[model samples]
Target: MKTIQLFFLILIIVSCSSNKKISVNTSKQSLKNQQLIIDTDINTENIIVEEISANTEIRLKKDSITTVNSYITAPVFDSILKPKHDSFNKLLSMFVSKEGFVHYKDLKKRQLDLQKYIFYLGENLPTQNWTKSDILAFWINTYNALTIDLILRHYPVKSIKDIKNPWQQRHWKLGDKWYNLDEIEHQILRKMDEPRLHFAIVCASISCPKLLNEAYTAENLEQQLTNATQDFLSDSTKNSISKDKVELSKIFNWFNADFTKNGSLIDFLNLYSPIEISKTASKSFKDYNWDLNE
Candidate 1:
C-alpha cells in the first residue's frame, strides 16, 4: 500500500511538471511571434527622421520670412508711443528759453533714447484732448519724429529718397489705420491745410526744413506750424525760384500729388513766395544728400 501511494504521488508531480513545460513553450512562441510582427515592414528610423526634417524645415522657413519682414519694417519706435505728462510744459519751456532748436547731430546720437520718450508720449496720447488742432499737432509730431528716425537709421544715404520706403513690405499701426510711409506723408500730413507743416516735418537732410528743438503744443501750435512753413519756404537754401523752373527740395517732387490737392506744385510754391513766379514746375528735382546730419 505504501509503494502504491508513493507511485501515485510521483505521477502527480510528473503531470504538473509536464503542464508547466507546455505552458512555458506556448508563451515563448507567442512572444517570438509578437516580436516578429513588431519588426516586420517597419522603417521606424526613416519615419522618425522624415518627421524631424519636416518640422525643422517648416520652422526654418517661418523664421526666415519674419526676419526679412523685420528688416523692411523695422519698428518705428522701440516701444509703443506714450504721452509725457509734462509734454506741454516741457515743450513750452524750450520755446520760451529759445532752446527749441533740435540739432540734427544731437538728435542722431540720442535716437534710441528719444524713441523711449516717444513711447511715453504714445502711452499718454489716448487720454489727451482730441481737438482737431491737438490731433493735428500730434500727427505732425509723430510724422516728424518718425521721419527723423528713418533718416538717422540710414544716416549716410545721399538723399531721403535713398531711404527706401520703410513700409514697402510691412504695415505700421498709426492712429486708426495701417499706414505706409507713403500714405502718412501724402494722405495725412499733406491733406492738412496747414502748409507750415512743410517745414516742421524735417527729412533729416540739409534741404528739408529744420527740426524743431521741442515738440509742438496746442497752446502755441498754430503759430509754431505757421512759422515753420514760412521759414522753410522762404529759406533760400531749401526753396528758391529761377527763371525757367523752381528749385525746390526733392520732397516736393516726391509728393507732388499732395501739393496738387489744393493747387499745383507751382501754385503751392507761389502762395508762399514773396515773388510772383511762373507756374512752370521744375523738370528735375535735385538729388538728396543722406550723409549724417552732423
Candidate 2:
C-alpha cells in the first residue's frame, strides 16, 4: 500500500507541472497577438491621416493656382478695329433704341448693312496687341451683332429660341473658326471671370438685361460694366428686393459661381442693389422671360 501511494503522488505532481506550463505559454501567445493587432490598427490610422493631408494639400494648391490666374491679364493681341468700331456703333444706334428696344422691323430694312457689319467683324479679328478690355469689347459686340443677325434671318419669330438650337448652331465665323452663341458666352466671356458680363450680354429676351444703346468700348469698359450692373439690379421688374427677402433674376442662379467667386450672391447684389440685404436674408429666383425683347 505504501509503494502504490508514492507512485500516485508522483503522477499528480507531474500533471500539475504540465498544466502550469500550458497556462504560461497560452498567456504569452495571447499578449503577442494583442500587440500585433494594436500595431496594425496604428498603421492603418497613420495611412488614413497621411492620405487626407495629401488631398488637402492638393486642393489648396489648385485653389492657389486659380487665384493667381484670375489676376493675370489676358495675352496681348495685335489687332485693330477702328472701322469695325464705327460700323458697330452705326448699327447699334440704328436698331437699338434709346429705351433699349430693338426695332427688328426697321433693322430688317437695313439687312444688307447689318450683313456687311458682321462680315467686317469676321475679317478684322483682334490681334495679339489688344488689351484684355479690347478683346472683351470686340467679342461682346460680335456676339450682339450676330444675335441681331440671327433674329432678322428668322424674322416673324416670337423668341430667340424659335430657331431650333439657336445657341448650339455654329452659324457665325470668328477669325478662322466657326462659333455658336454658347461658345462665345461660356468658352470666351465666362472664362474671363467677369461676372457683370451676365448683365452686359443681352439674350434678346424681355428678362435679359437691356441692350445698351452704345457699343461696349474698351476705353469705357469698366464704367459700362458698373453701369450695367447698377441698371440691371435697380430694375425691380428683374430683381425685386425687400429687407428680409430678395428675388433676383435667373441670371444670378445660372451663373452663381461667377458672381460668388469673391463673396456670396448677396454680397454681389449689395454692390449694385438699391435695397440693403442682410447676409442671412431669404433668397429666391424670378421666373425667366424668354419672350422676344422687342
Best candidate (score: lDDT): 2
Q: Model 2 TM-score?
A: 0.71
Clashes of each: 19, 9
lDDT tens per residue, model 1, 237-270: 6677665666777777776666677767777777
Worst 10-residue lDDT window, candidate 1:
71-80
Clashing pairs in 2: 76-128, 77-127, 77-128, 77-129, 77-130, 78-127, 78-128, 78-129, 79-127
What's the TM-score of each model vs. the native? 0.52, 0.71
- Could you tell me the C-alpha RMSD of candidate 1 in Å? 16.8
Compare the candidates by TM-score and give the number of the best one: 2
- The C-alpha local distance difference test score for the whole of candidate 2 amounts to 0.80
